[model samples]
Target chain A: MNGVKSESVREPLILGNPSLGDVSDKIAGIIESPPTKKFWALVTITSIIALQGLCSVAYTVWVGPGVWGVNNPVGWGWAITNFVWWIGIGHAGTLISAILFLFRQKWRTAINRSAEAMTIFAVMCAGLFPLLHTGRQWIAAYWLLPYPNQMQMWTNFRSPLEWDVFAVSTYFTVSLVFWYTGLVPDFATMRNRIKNVLGRNLFSFFSLGWTGSTRNWAHYEMAYLILAGLSTPLVLSVHSIVSFDFAVSVIPGWHTTIFPPYFVAGAIFSGFAMVMTLLIIARWVLNLHDFITLKHLDNMNKIMLATGMMVGYAYAMEFFIAAYSENPYEQYVFLNRAFGDYAWAYWSMVSCNVLVPQIFWFKKLRRSIPAMFVASLLINVGMWFERFVIIATSLHNDFIPGSWDYYSPSWVEVSIYVGTMGIFLTLFLLFAKFVPMLAISEVKGVMPGAQPKHDHH
Target chain B: MEEQTLTQPVKSESAETEASAHMEQPDARATSDPLAVMGDFVDPNEVTDAARAIHAAGYTDFDIYTPYPVHGLEKAMGMKKTILPFFSLGGALFGLGNAIFLQWWTGTLHYPLNIGGKPFFSPWFGMPVMFELTVLLCALTTAVVMFGLLCKLPQWHNPFQKDAGFRRAVDDTFVVVIEAKDQRFTVDSATNLLEKLGASNVRLVNV
Candidate 1:
């Protein structure tokens, strides 16, 4: 009995020794309390930014793809770059919720609800770039899907682009359902506690009459385990298919077998950085430092550090493979990436993706709020440039020098990217306000004395 | 913290229903009354004990409820393992079959075009779509079947909701409810048994 107790015992996931009711009151109270002045200010700012991004999308649809800076050789410019970056940003959420949950990372319960929300919002932002880039947005459905139309043409199953349609759409749908399944119990808690009639009715409808019965929990736990199992593979597959978009192409820099794993690492790295950036501000503003503890921040920073090294290793491997292949086209692409016109972007990627996270080796910096907050921002910037360096640098200089030209985003392109940020933040803010940002039920489950005591022989 | 005082059993104020099933009379009460005796428990260990005691007393229709899933309580109540994984497997097979048919038929038979001299139908290229669809279908089936069919959730009018004390189950308290429909169930015996086994705020409410 003593041995078993010693093995299982550890620092509590939640701090201040909160009781189960305190856990409910602390989380649900965020939603019940009237909106604070700071909350309104942030909402106003993000909503305005989101509106601007929506307008940019509308303008692009009205004006055509010519409004952006994509030319003959550099056709896949900021739009594709932003699409990949946004999608990569979403990977952290699933990594935390599905992957970490399977590994029995008890600390994830504090932040998984919000991280999954961020994942859905990030994917929504990611989808906008691809949808708007289609030029004729109205007819995109026909082009993307294998639906039977009067044209009698089937979407090319062999094409990686066709694979992307299934990969991303399936990813979004599955993530949404997985997130909602976790939310149902939390919603039931809201249903029982909220004072207002309208809020109560809404929670009642969404909660699905969850009574927390052990019989029902038996089924609910099974369903949750199954979803997490499915999402683990689905998350890896989504980004691999995204990588297939570039890898399947015959372009010198793009055609590499290493793209899938490399892209996945970079996605997790950037996604964690974004999560850290948002979480730091959220914990501070919401006064949830006890729940979103320094330990959680330290764990996240370590992940960013590990994934950052994977990305750095992939970057070096790409160069070595380019030189070893005895192919001048590949060699030139790598050389041009580092030494030619877009050297600034390449170096930025290296510094941010490779160099910046090295600061986390110091335990103090990893746990320090200001140090991590700034590092998270720089890492995301580095990731964005990493995508741009991959896309624009490869496309800008072609086989023949005659077709070579510089690529830069037009105002519309720049605004659209910024607008997506606005849209993402606005949705996150709304979610933080209206929903229990912490998984209330889950957080309670991991608290000290949460489980029934058992005597071991 | 005042709510955690469990030294004495606090009988519910609104036990307006007839308490006809006292220890003196072990027989059935009037059939008109649909009584579900609920006991509010402060600790999970105590709830497990009460559930074990109630189950051992030959009552088959009883449940334990808590704010979150209590690990041993399901075993203490003797719940059968759910078959949700089987449904998930069925969904995966269906998705895999559909994806194979769609790709094979469309690529080879429906409209075959020679692009870059690649084969019309190769499983290598088709794997991504197949994997995505399989996961998507499996996830959907698990969620829908678990909530809608197996658990019978989204039931806004659950009989337990009529008892106001039941609200604490989702908040802090662990609850055990022995349905009045149980053959061995009597309101007085259920209430007396719960109070005897260290449950606080015992009450019988018509559901």
Candidate 2:
């Protein structure tokens, strides 16, 4: 494993062959430096956008869901679609942090901390839609829980929507804990590096006064392993339960049994794309190209291509099932998606999700920075359309012909969605500024020649 | 954990004389007793060798601190496998039970509603909630127990923090500290052992 490096066999996880001290200096240096003008400018813009979203949410609560585009037949509209899209974007973080860790993919060390932060923030954005979508959000929010009320009313445990309340909250809490656990040692690194008394104290408190004792690392590794183990099924289940929100209903487009795997694949597909988009910019902005190498980008593109194909296959199977069942309503729904009122969204989903990723089959396109960046952005748009098509098209022209109507988002709805993007990016930028963008200790652990030469066994 | 001053010289060695000359102003909070004998090593392999030597010499109260978790260093130090998984299991069962009761009591017995005449309490529909709650409780419990009980962390005030050289352990240096509380420890013996094991920058510090 040591003599001569081979590219095909295994590329080095970190480039430039930096020493341990250099790793600390490079990553911690980002936090030590004052925020750049670009960072402040970006934050200001995102904060304004996020504030606009807050106003939209407040106005909706003051008025009602009537402010949005939903009508009788199109009761579930952009709100639900955005909720699923944001939640789907959150999945890639868990996949990179938990699933990849379990698979012993060493490259994850460079990206996991930031990816986990993205997961937490994306879930926050996702949770906002469902909370505010309810007309009387303040009273309706707690109604999802199985708490006793004055009227003796209890939540229906069988409802998929109620199940979503539990799944999403649990995902957020678990992800936060896992992310914090991974950050403790790195916090210690920050504590040691920061010269300011207050900054040092803050990092020290968060670091839990970590001394890096062998005894502590033993238990730390055990806790990390258990978290990764638990999170694997939890991440898969979170999306599966989200899919159940549709599959449990008798709607022709959503009633299929394959929604679970389909949604999970789409979640991972959108999530990796989102991660790629953020990381490509992050590596460039932070001057971390040596750590987050081109190989990492190439590897992520391959995963996106694979999952994109899975999403395409699911789309094909849905259409096949509709025609094969000999059910005219199901057949009409699929046909309507393709050629009816929302064919634009359907085609957009197919072209961006199905066709765009095909470029990754060529290694040059996969490895190219500009090509992958644009592809990541398009995939994000495509994934949003995928959810939009699933929810809007399915609900618009249902069994009753008289109730069908064209649905479009109000300014309020679009503002709210844009606000979520602002919220996500703002929180992410603040996190990137204050926190170590890479998992410092974990990256050091994976560096070539970081460990001892001898095998204990 | 006991603190007592060791004003008497441990040895007539030049290194001790140099370290003592360096300790001109100890922190007001630090005890005058020599808490541990310390060694700094840059290479992880050398630290692993030093840990093995110390453990083989039957000194149980020693620790090696590194910038990252070095492979095989824990085993070389003869540390025991952690029992965190068992606690995780306990938490999972507790959560599973909580979910079952929450669902069964709410759906079947308490204020049950007839939606499509579906069964009030089937494990199949309740599985998602059940699985999520289990993982949630298990993760929280593991974190709490690992930090509070096993690792005993969140100790912002530590003896090692008094020594400036100790800070380097988180960056590039590997630290081997043999506490004075160890059965085989004496300032002279510990310092001699470290130097004999090819440790550099060995020092005796009052923590």
Candidate 3:
């Protein structure tokens, strides 16, 4: 059986058998070195794209949500689709950092930093959509927050949209702190290494006088553990809350008890794909193959495969439940998703997400870098379409055929979506250039013979 | 090296007598005086062993510093479990209570309006916000309590920063520092003790 030989089949996570010093040098060297031509080229392109996104957003705000193709029935269009897509991409980072850490997965150490950075950046992009979508951000933003005023008006806490406000903001804040806490020790390392005044001062300020003392380590470990515990539920809850924006509604396809878990699974599935897309390029561009090795990619591919299957199962279950219940509305929604106006989006999602990831079930394909990269890109496209289909198809034709209209995104809406990619890439490029993209101290901890042998009395 | 080891006991004994004399006038050295005798070890194992030895030698106020958290070193150094969990729990409870009160106050008490015949406040509807706030506050409190209270962070200036050897504590070296204010501390005795415990470079750091 495939299970019988599992123990012998597993590969060493860090390839090339690099030493701790070598690992630190290779990873830190990327930050210390002058930016390469390719690095500059990538950054410039991404920056230009980010600029385009900014322009699109400015245009949208200066005009109105009318710039989008959203109409009466399809009120939530590209903005909500992109918002959910970006938020879902953000999930993989917390999953890798917090959930995997809780499970004691050591491979996460290689990618957690970059993934968390992606999470922060992706969430930043995701947060912009709802604000811009409001059409009057200045007033809507303040109105969203629960602040005391002379009128005694407060944000409706009973609404899932309000829950989104709190959930997303809290998720962002906690993720930031969690990310920074992990950075402290490495910042201390950088502070110690730098010779110049500016570098030393900047790093020292951020490092927070971390001496790596046993007492500090004791407390630091506890804090990390606690944050991990807190963030694990948060990663799940954030997406579940995002799902609540739909599930709590009485829309035909939107209302379901399975939405929370299914959304969470889809979030992680998409998130891992995005992480793979960025990291595959990064590991090659930055020459960090020794640290972010084939083993790491293989393991990540395995996760994508698993989660992708979970999503596919959820997709099938939705249809099964719809048909089994004999509810005409729910049944119609599923039928519309499959064979109606937005059927192209639905089939693309199914083929790319459900079918393509199955290639990873073969051990050979999972380990192949090029194959995995292509699959990752496909999965990302699939996941985006999954969101688009859910939002557009479900909302497009409700109960009345008289109100039905074919929805198509305007240029502004399309530009904004593409612009988010630019924003995500630009931030990622900056992070790769400036930050220690791998966990140096953590990798050191996992080195052979790194742990001290105690003489038990 | 053998001669150095042989001559250490005499020096340690004399320092012990001097330390005993100083112990009688402990407050004579003001509280503002420098705190610790710091030593650097090239090997993590050596520092871990030294931490155990120093703990066994009855010195309570001491610490080991390393680039990464050394497994089992907490137990070896006899560090007590942290109270961060309690702080997190306290924060969570506060956040949950605050969320419920705010929801109840805003929806039911302050300016309530009926929507879709739903109740003014539903606990199920409020669960998402409550859960988010609970996790948010719990994580924030844990981080604040850990970095601010326990670790005493944001003090960018530390006496150990002046020592180039101590800087390696954040890189590849391991360091052990026994506070000068400890009952058994004297410069000579602490130096001898650290040297005997395989410390490579031992020095007294003044803040």
Candidate 4:
């Protein structure tokens, strides 16, 4: 098969020459049968990790945000950093499902379902941070909304935080609907394939009595198209609004017009990396080489390479603009980022996000599973540090020299970050075991000779 | 066994004559309270051809079911375009207006506070939320409206679900069902048409 060029040629997405029956049977089998020992082992580990995160959140809520690390100089620390990191990781799913779909990328059909699931779960993980960041989350959560109150107090509509409330929540709702709508027909397939009454009933309920009627298919296809159309902008707008949370500020390092596009490109960059990390393992574990082929992995790595470069350019531009603008504070911030106390993080971000992904420029390394996996893991690390650098470095060293106190994350902050990973992995593991990780009907659509020939007349 | 016999070519002169003859007389035997006459086809191509023949013969109350969506099957079935887009548009407009009005009312009128000397109701600042709410409502309305109003889903107990051949509709079979309630439906005529159009099995199902 041809590699990662956007030429007008049809490559067989499903390799190994599997028939339609074999495709359905193999994918649906994972969900139908009992979980394997490895599946149980992975689930158990992720569950424990998730439980740790839950406990960390509980302790943070119990004591206050002080349990973590946040002082006068650096108000936003690891919590916000992890929030941005997780949110960025969620971007790839929508990009794969909506953007690539609009571009007619058939390679996406093999991976979109799991990617969408990853988006939802990652958003769920990301949502936990903002809530936990608020010391009194119970009250602070409701206070974020603009519901009428006895005191007639309303949330400031001018605040980017309020805009964020609408943006992220709308994003979650749209992603969930888009994900479930795609699942309906596949759920019907499961309902017919499974033998257990309970399993059949559950699938049937979700399937909504889908008969695959031509009329139902017609409407279903239209609704799906409209949703994809709507989600494309919604996905871009989500990260843009997230960037607004930083760009709207007047702080020397935070206030920049390029934050929106920079953050979006970074989000997709980290998202594709995370998808690669997960799919690489999943392809091996689930024996999905025929579906999630090396071709798919190569294409994803190329995206990581491109977006990583875009992020790298953003990094360079920020420095260039900082020096060119001749703003002392901005120059100081840039200098401090490179040679300051947080220089370790700055260099790490540079090496991981920018330098490491450059290896994918070679065709062999791009196709190498181990190299791609390592690069993806490093990219995730780099992306997380990228957020940390953006949030902590800028905040730690303010304009006034008196307030330049170094900040370090306490154990609580570290645990919460690790716990979010647990939550993400746990949800993903369950999704892999239960839901058809591959979109069966879509895979069929891309299979060779699946479509019937129609007369032009 | 019965499917083999049903696939035999009808021993008649022309499809038009047979269809008109069936339409002229509503046979009592054919109208004996049968729920529907269902035909199963192995290939989607055959189903598409059968759908064309059935539609051309002027059967309006027929439906085609398949394992996966068959392209061009809707055109062959002569189905009309759905009204779901209008619902989505309406929802989007409502959401946009509501967001604008709510943000304006809250930021400007209800409990306005001048922060950093910025305007109370900045439409520029509110654009993201407005855009988000519009997309949110549009997506949700499209899903609910299509599933609830158009597809009329959650129909857990459709009579066709009991048919053995119908089970394969979600697996590897294509089926066409013509309701007996149609003005021009007769058992022999429907079964003969389905067979002539290349159906593998034609069975009459009770509601």
Clashing pairs in 1: A208-B154
lDDT of 4 by residue, A103-217 (tens): 9898999999999999999999898888887779878845688787787888877788888888889999999999999999889888876867788889989999998888999
CA RMSD, predictions in order: 4.6, 5.2, 6.5, 6.2
DockQ, all candidates in order: 0.56, 0.47, 0.41, 0.40
- lDDT for model 4 comes to 0.86
In model 4, chain B matches the true chain B with a TM-score of 0.82
Candidate 2 TM-score, true structure as reference: 0.95
Give me the runs in candidate 4 sitting further than 4 Å from their true place: A1-9, B1-33
lDDT by residue for model 4 (B134-168), tens: 99889999999999889999888776665556655
lDDT winner: 2
User: How well does candidate 1 reproduce the true complex, by DockQ?
Assistant: 0.56
TM-score: model 2, chain A: 0.97
Output the lDDT of residue A77, model 4.
Answer: 93
For residues A130-166, write the lDDT of model 2, one tens digit per residue.
Answer: 9887779878845787776787888878789999999
* True-structure lDDT of candidate 3: 0.85
Which of 1 and 3 is ahead in TM-score? 1
- Pick out the ten consecutive residues of candidate 4 chain A with the lowest summed lDDT: A1-10
**Models ranked on DockQ:** 1, 2, 3, 4
lDDT of 2 at A395: 88
lDDT of 3 at A348: 99
